[model samples]
Target: MSRTATAVPPQGTPLRRHGRTKIRYRTRGLAWAFMAPLLIVNLLVIGGPGLASFFYSFTDWDGLGSANFVGIANYVELFTSPAVLSAIQHNLIWTGFFLVVPMSMALLGAFLLSRVRRGQILFRVLFFIPYVLATIVSSIIWRQILSPTAGIGQALQGIGIDWFADTNFLGDPALALGSVAFINNWQWWGFLLVLFLAAMQGVDPALYEAARLDGANAFREFWHITLPGIRPTLMFLMLMTVIWSFLVFDYVFILTQGGPAGSTDVIGTVLYRTAFSENRAGYASSMAMLLTVISAAIVLGYQLLRKKLKWEV
Candidate 1:
């Protein structure tokens, strides 16, 4: 019997590479398919406007007509202008208030709720109710409550309590900014409380039991166990709070319009007024760029700190 040999290619031939090529191509196509819509939308909405703002920040564009390049003049004016300076100062103060007030209230509220065995859901709902309300509705409700002529003040005056009877919270320069902060806090702290409570609920029960067995009080347990356990959530919320404080606009604009003599003016309001009211769109773009830079710097700093300290979150 005669045997005929069939040709066999050596190992690592191109014939075996076809499968990997097909897989790679398929994976790339699937990825693009999933990402296409989001990428397109982001390009249209964010990237376009952001690039335009960056370009216009170096020019004098009045929202119409030709844009003339002005170099860094707008930034110089932004830093030197007293209104902008004051607005920046107000932003700092707002950030401080949010960092301290809402964070403290939320942590305390969440801790208390976490310890509750009865009516926890009811208390949570009540606390979160204000956060669920529309911003406009909340602002109006607070405005009425703070109204001197026909609201709480008058009601209190009728009952012979005059402490806030004559107080014009939103109209007085000294009180306008603080009043807005208070109103915003009223709506904000509850949301934070719910978030913190959720974080606390995720904490290991064994940790708490261990702490109790060690004769640790509630405060010590919270300081040592709860805080570290929920560090990721707490840190994230703190970062967001800082960023939001800088971008705060709606409440101040609705309640005070950056007045009582611009006492409550923040960078957000100042940017709005500069762009639309004063017809300095270029300058407003500069302000927007400044805000973007600040936010970016904050995020970058956080990332660096996390890397340096080897934070898991």
Candidate 2:
């Protein structure tokens, strides 16, 4: 009572607490050690170049000289440039096409594949094979297949079919953009199919069974259960599709080179031309910044939507 019954410390308690603390610190240190190499590499590669691009965007650097600060002149030109505007318009069209066509095809294909009890693996392999092919290889193959003189058109003409006999898919300004998109989609939708199939496989079978018991048809079951189950993957892929559509260069560059009167010219091709072909690196940098800003805005909009919708995914 006199000394408030001076509480006796539990023996080894402090040591036990200190041991846990030391272990936590050691664990954290080990994790950082494991992450250090990758972090350093990203900082050097991605971060450094990103910072340089941002700095050069405001300048008038012609790729090999002193960067003279021009303060938004490049940005102004980037916005006002006719070629850039045309490229952006094409990019928007491309984004719309990919957002609809591949996504729909993949979703339908994946859903059907999910119901298959046999030969599913073979189908998957066949579908994914095109996606695994190198872009250049696929582009070349499609180019040959779409050739006006010796391609499907000629093959069909041999069979007394005159539908595509005169069609120059890649050479016609009206057809070039669509032709490139179709070729890209041929290699793209399959990849999306595989991913959607994987995501669908994770959906609960019980839900489908319940839907069936409630007399729900295939489409209804898919609409209610399958879609919600794989929404996270769906949303993520759509986001990436939007970003990638803006950055599409490979297929266009290889097959069309944004040719046929620049009908298929996208932001990527324009940026390439500005930077290397035209020796306007600063203007190209500003274009890069525009792409970055657009991508960032899309991501931020997605985040806001997700938050507002209280999406658990």
Candidate 3:
């Protein structure tokens, strides 16, 4: 005798409530197809160039000439060169200042703004306005403002302070790097503040409520709740700052052009001077490769730290 198979529904359940499982699979496949173009673009634009750069770093290809193969000589020379070493140090200083200046100020601005009631939107717009302006435009504007004949310098001179004529904002080696750093922080803070504000808005309301009801003051609430809520965003911003610090070229190029006496030369400016200005493409590529490695190490270390943090949480 042949046995008959029976289908049974356990408990109170709806078996034929919606469409068949096949529909879900087809929907996922369609979604993947829609995302295909984006993936291709990312690979082509970002990944392709990165791979090409890595490959070129090993060869000597001067703009229009044939590539001559050199082993690790480029890297060897990079380590031996004092200018290169100083540039790397300057890059680190830039990164450090960026974290302390822009990121801290932005976070503080976000924290304060979140507590404000009236005209929040207006403040957000005002703070973010500077970021919308291009680096070159801002640099030019600052140049005029710092000029001795017409702007801050003139006003100072009118009071017998004479900051520009006496102190040399752009000409002094010791102060030029700080000047660029200030410009960078001033231009970037608005964007970062906006980002922090947006991220803060997404934090869970219940967490704040609970913290308040538990005898937590505003500072306490922020320490325990707000910081935890925006930890991920903070990590991301930190990483992005590090990457951008190393890749800084536009502002440095336009504003100081690697400084009055190479005092403000960071990795990017150094690389540009080598590759284009001095016609040492291979050497520049080697410096670039080292920078890439450093950036990767930082990002990787942060990711590992994040993973550990998640586990602890």
Residue 134 in model 3: shift from native, Å?
1.2
Q: Rank the candidates by lDDT, best first.
A: 1, 2, 3
List runs of model 2 lying over 4 Å from the truth: 1-29
Extract clashing residue pairs from model 3.
none
What's the CA RMSD for each of the models? Answer: 5.0, 4.1, 4.7
Superior by TM-score: candidate 1 or candidate 3 = 1
**Predicted candidate 3 versus true structure: per-residue lDDT over 174-288, tens digit per residue:** 8888888888788899899999988899999899898888889988877888888887788788889999998888888888889887899988889999899888787788888
Residue-level lDDT for 33 in candidate 1: 96
lDDT of 2 at 26: 100
| Candidate 1 residue-wise lDDT, 154-262, digit = tens | 9999999988988999989999999999999999999999999999999999999999999999999999999999999999998999999999999999999999899
Which should have the higher lDDT, number 1 or number 3? 1
Q: State every prediction's TM-score relative to the real structure.
A: 0.91, 0.91, 0.86
Off by over 4 Å in 3: 1-6, 9-32, 160-165, 311-313
